[model samples]
Target: MKTLHDLHRPLGATGLMVSPLGLGTVKLGRDQGVKYPSGFTIPDDRDAANLLALAQELGINLIDTAPAYGHSEERLGKLLRGQRDNWIIVSKVGEEFESGQSRHDFSPQHTRFSVERSLKLLGTDCIDLVLVHSDGQDVEILKDTGVYETLDALKREGAIRAFGLSGKTVEGGLLALDKGDCAMVTYNLNEQSERQVIDHAATLGKAILIKKALASGHVCLDSGVDPVQASFELVFGHPGVASAIIGTINPLHLSHNVRVAVSVIQSRR
Candidate 1:
């Protein structure tokens, strides 16, 4: 089977090389009412760091994080420091936070604070990619607020290398594609609802990274092997997908994922 390590793909014409599969930090620092992997009772800072380092060594260049996911940005920053030149960091803004919980808010001030906070937590002068976590279905985008303006300002200042949107729905993804430079979406073998959005995002010459490519572990069930390998191949096979962010606490599993992607690439070749 192929793993991500062998598949050297460009990051949506950004000129950065990334594997088809990336290590997602969502579970490492997030326990926000969402079901997490077993034995992940709390933030294992050491384990998280080790896995992150391994991912980089295995050729996974992109690490996706968000402020909404607990201390995800902080821990990822800690692990990638000094080695920052070795990885591509992507963070999200526009999410409202309160009392260990968060909600999406596109207020201009909120956007500014989110970018600053992400920078502080990430411990970096510039993040490779910044995604605006959608406040809702693309409805709020219709409003004339400083959200887009704020993002443009950050880009102009070089605080962020590029900007995109982490959409919540198919409509949100399409709206983001129409209005933003990059579009973070969820599309897997089992679901094709976002197919049009993915295609359009490709046509826009914007970067399109796939999330939930394994259907958030749903595709792993009923299959004896790790679904990530299969999932990575599936998404990478699509024309618009540039990369797929995936989660794994086990270093061996991570390596297996890379191997699976490599095999897939070799098969196609």
Candidate 2:
């Protein structure tokens, strides 16, 4: 049986090795304004801790969180107190969620502040990776805003090891890699519009982390096919993909995802 740890790969030239699947924690903090197929309750500390332990048992080492994920950073800070060194923490800047709403601030100052806050909230001296939480204005945010520049400075200062954009556009992903180390783009069975970004990343030796790999749990595949298996096959089949961030607080689902992901990855070899 292959564990996810067996399939860990380099995240571009960032010097950070990550598993093929990362745990996304949006459901750990916020339950509003989400686009999931069904509603879910936020897991309490015990449940969340169990899920984290299960992830480790299944060999996941990358965790994805953001300030826009309500109190996710703080919760993980407490939950992962002694095990910080075991995982690669991937966070974001420029988007904030409060009072059931979200807002964007990509200014240099806010970017700096967000990174500092994320550090504090995550209880880490240095975040392994920090991506710009873009607000659909991907091109403008990268070109007009100094957000990437600020993140580059933070990386140099050792506050963050790598930086890039969790962008919504192909242009933004390419530009982000041109300026940074990674780009988290949407790539799955339903949407291959960002395929160009993945190809470009492969060519340039940069990282491409995938989001919405399961279509936010609304996967609509053919009747006979297993959605989860198909999703992992499509994601890991691409050589450029570093990891797919899947958000699920359910232990069974997490285990299943890791199993399918490992099967796909190992078969490719």
Candidate 3:
């Protein structure tokens, strides 16, 4: 039997390798104000560097962050500078950020700027993959030739090793996954509405990663569940799911998350 640590696997039908588990930096860096609307606000940055180092040592290599995740990309880049070769950094486009209140930036110039800034902030020459982050609105711009064609050109220049979508809705998620290259992340399992999409991932050859599966840890408490197993395994059980992106601020919490991820993958076999 593969131990919990060994459950991390390569992405399906692609050369991209990842630990089936990943470390999300939103809590450690971007989170601000109370987490009332969400849950469990982030801790201070005292241990952000330490925890990230620990995650890397533990072989959790898919490090995810976004410009929308205020300070997350900068913090991660600061800690991970010069080690770009050892990690796969995934950033997002379509999110606009200026003076801390920004919206979607789908124009080719803005999209290009987003990638350039992400690369600069992360202290890397190239990004392993880039996803267009959606907040469940105005996604018609995605089908536009300008944004995608720009991304395709970046792939050719090797500025991005791959490209894909990260949608907030099933209509948008499925469209992006089917029409473009690579994967999409969405709210899965908790929403029965997404079941067909989850099932469809297996047949599509498109890598499907899940987010909010634990309902940001809300459903777990409400439904009398621990959330770790239910959320991780529910989506991961589907052959389509490549991984579930979860975030935390504490080292012990991250350790627990790693255990859950390992358990989910191991149980499937």
Candidate 4:
């Protein structure tokens, strides 16, 4: 069986190599206002540590987290500890979750503050990637705010390696790729509306990190079809997809996901 590390590839032209299966860390922090099909308790430190260890063992290097994910950043800081160099940490700015509510602020000031805070929280000097957490109005945020520009500045200053938008719309994804190194889009069996964005990224050598690739575990596959295998096949079938961020907290699910992802990727090759 191939480990995820065997499937690592360039993140567009960003110069950072990431696993085909990046682990999403939403369940490590906040639990409110999420759209998961079922509820899950936030894992304790020991459990979280075991999960990370399993991810590392499976050769997963890319990790996804954001300020909107509640205490995720801080928890990762503690859990990751001395193993920072073993993983590629991807955090985000613009969206903030607090008091059981979520809000957005894409101003340049907020963008800078968020990156700096993430650095402090994660106990790292430079983040591998940081993205703009768009609030539905992807095009407006990209054009109206100085957020992308601020991220560029931060990148040049060595606070972040690369930056882009975790966008909501096809237009926004295209625009983000036009100005940045990557764009996180929602693509899965249920959603192919962003295929244009993926094609565009492929043409431009920009990274496309897939969100909701399994439809947040709400997938309705045909009877007798294996949902995990089917989802991985659909996602990895795309030549432009750099990675799929699966946010599974269950260890068995994580291992199964990696195995399925490896099989799908290998079959494609």
Q: Candidate 4 residues 56-153, lDDT tens each?
A: 99999999999999999999998998999999899999999999988999999999999999999999999999999999999999899899999999
**Please, what are the lDDT tens digits per residue for candidate 2 over residues 132-191?**
999989999999989989999999999999999999999999999998999999988889
Q: What is the lDDT of residue 126 in candidate 3?
A: 86
Candidate 1 vs. true structure, TM-score: 0.89
Better of 1 and 2 by lDDT: 2
Off by over 4 Å in 1: 1-6, 37-39, 142-144, 220-226
Model 1 C-alpha lDDT per residue in residues 20-127, reported as the tens digit of each score: 777788777766565544545544778777787778777788888888878788877777778888788888887754576667777778888888889998889988
Prediction RMSDs, each to the true structure: 2.5, 0.8, 2.8, 0.8
Q: Higher-TM-score candidate among 3 and 4? A: 4
- Estimate candidate 4's alpha-carbon lDDT, on a 0 to 1 scale: 0.93
Q: lDDT for model 1, on a 0 to 1 scale?
A: 0.75
Clashes of each: 11, 0, 1, 0
Whole-model Cα lDDT per candidate? Answer: 0.75, 0.93, 0.70, 0.93
Model 2 poorest ten-residue lDDT run: 1-10
The TM-scores of all predictions, comma-separated, are 0.89, 0.98, 0.87, 0.98
